[model samples]
Target: MGHVFRTEQQALALDSLSRFLKAEVEPLYWHDYRDTFVPKEKLLPVTQQLAEFGLVSGVVSEEYGGLGADWLTNAMLFEEVAFTSCDLALLVLINSFGAYMLEKLASEALLERYLPGLVNGSRFVSIAISEPDVGSNVVEIKARARSTGENYVLSGEKTWISNGAYSDVLICTCRTSDEPRGGLTHFLLDRSEHPYEVQNIKKVALNSQSTAQVFLPEIVVPAHNMLGEKGEGLRNTLALFERSRVFVALCAVGIARRALHEAVHYAQERVQRGKKIAGHQLISAMLAEMATQVDAARLLCYRAAQMIEADLSAEMEAAMAKYFACEAAVKVTRQAVQIHGGNGVTTDFMVEKLAREALILPIPEGTSQIQQLIIGRALTGVNAL
Candidate 1:
């Protein structure tokens, strides 16, 4: 990583996004989840605003109403968005991610039909890859999509998916063949065409727009709906994951920054031993470590994002960024809680909530353990996962 977080103009743009989060998203998004569901009324307005923001537009071509920026710029944008609310950051992320994979690999016809809607935020889409039996192992997917004469019968259940409850379009990973690496295939299907069940997952310390389980039981889709060539599902998905993991790093960057901000503020005003806590040597040391670690995570994300922009495979770089950044976030947030003392676990303090949210970071995209496996392979030249 060049250690450059952003260009001057990009920094200004992100500053503007930070202001938008404080004014528009912070009040409602931070505390609004219905049981386990995020209300559409809250998500809709912000999503529509995001449509005009060009984060999602960066993935598509200028001919298709996108900014067409490099993947690194999009990753930076996600970092800023994550600072506002991790749940809200995911909305922008899903928008861009689903759009990116489709525009890159799906047919021209499919792009024409959905890019406008997706880019404009008229419709929501999500990538469906994880299943009950499968976590980081993409090849072990039990979801099957058999091609019939004119259509494919899709039957499977996907869990831990972003936007699973509300997305109208699902970029599904399905088993298309029995071949080793090429057995899986991608499909861009309209959920309206096939009635599927969705159950919102209840979780702890989660900052997600919406998380749900999608049940695809004997659903049918047209032959044209298949994304890319048959038997390339895992390949396409891994390619996307290499980039997506960088965004996961940025997500940690945003979250860790917020935790640092809250802790610094609280420390300055908190009195202990007849003095401000921040004046204490130990408290200042903790703050210094947090700032340094957050910067390191951001730099790693930038390096991975740059690799992606250069059209590199970037599996090792992405895993390193994702693993280190997320683990750092958990550590940073926990320390932020320690700085808050007994109030750290209460609803009155943001650090308590932020700490809880940080707990969810090491699980999504790929667990910290999975990222270690990927990194271990690159270092030792041995496949670990």
Candidate 2:
């Protein structure tokens, strides 16, 4: 609940990342890949660059090829990444959390096998949880991994899987039992070894990133590929969600902040009634509201991040931050578009893209409705979901 200021190391790292973005990634993103899917070949280099700053697989310990930064520091770096490119931010997020889970749950040999490529960004990873039928209700997952002799036959369809098409490894959630919450388990599936199918799913925004349908059709996975205990998937996943939701909230904040910047820049340059629109009372008021909302949302995200770094259970706080920030992004980006007037809808400007990107924020992590239900459960001690 206390305010968390950035440490000197985090500040320097942020500065370095900002410089790198402006100098290298920004030009590349705008020049060739803003409106289309960024190829894995192009993305891997940037991922490796990010790894140098301890961001690609951040939050894992230094002993296992990570920076060992705290959650708040990682959140700070993550927001900066999102500001430059939300698409890349999502990729970094998947890699970071995927590595986090690997470090926390994988056996020593498993970690030894995967951690090197992941840390260096030579390999891409994804966490497959959502399915064709399952959304917020994780217990309803039908993806099953039937045990056999020293191997499990995995069969399931995981949809809305980020990095699915590009992933070399997947941390897939599967149903290993029929005991509701305890039935879910996670499996580490190597694409070369297990051979699952993937098809990219096109979307309204953030197309520079891959969102795909992953089909695991009776893939043979060795028993060693099982992540954690058989029934501990839900608990580990929920724990990851507490921290991951905060990072998602920060992504929303970054988008809104960029939108605000665009609006302010446009308002000051555009003339209306012989004066800059920024001087007009209405435009000024709208800018004020957008700025205020962005700041408030960012503060909420940081609060949740701080709580997570302090080793606290941030379920309710994470839900609150994710709910408020994502909703605020929708509002803030729309206002940015309104400020841009007729030009807002055109592809010539970046505000339109920001608006489109913001639209996707409220749905990921959890829907705004889901976050509200989580807060409701926290406050009333009643399970709303």
lDDT of each candidate versus the true structure: 0.83, 0.89
Question: Where does candidate 1 have its weakest 10-residue lDDT segment?
Answer: 29-38
Q: How many residue pairs clash in all the candidates, one count each?
A: 0, 0
Return the lDDT, model 2, position 272: 86
Candidate 2 residue lDDT tens string, 274-365: 99999999999999999999888888888888888888888999999999999999999999999999999998888899888999988877
Predicted structure with the largest lDDT when compared to the true one: 2
Look at candidate 2 and give me any clashing residue pairs. none
lDDT at position 380, candidate 1:
100
Q: Say which candidate scores most in TM-score.
A: 2
**Which segments of model 1 are wrong by more than 4 Å?**
1-5, 31-36
lDDT of 1 by residue, 1-385 (tens): 1256568867886677778878887777665551245667667777777666656876777987888877777777777778878877776778788988888887889888888888877778888899999997778899999989899999989998888777888888899887858899888878777676778787785534677899998999888999888888887888888988888788888899889988999999999999999999999999999999998998888888888888877999999999999999999999999999999888877887777778888888989999999999999999878
TM-score of each: 0.95, 0.97
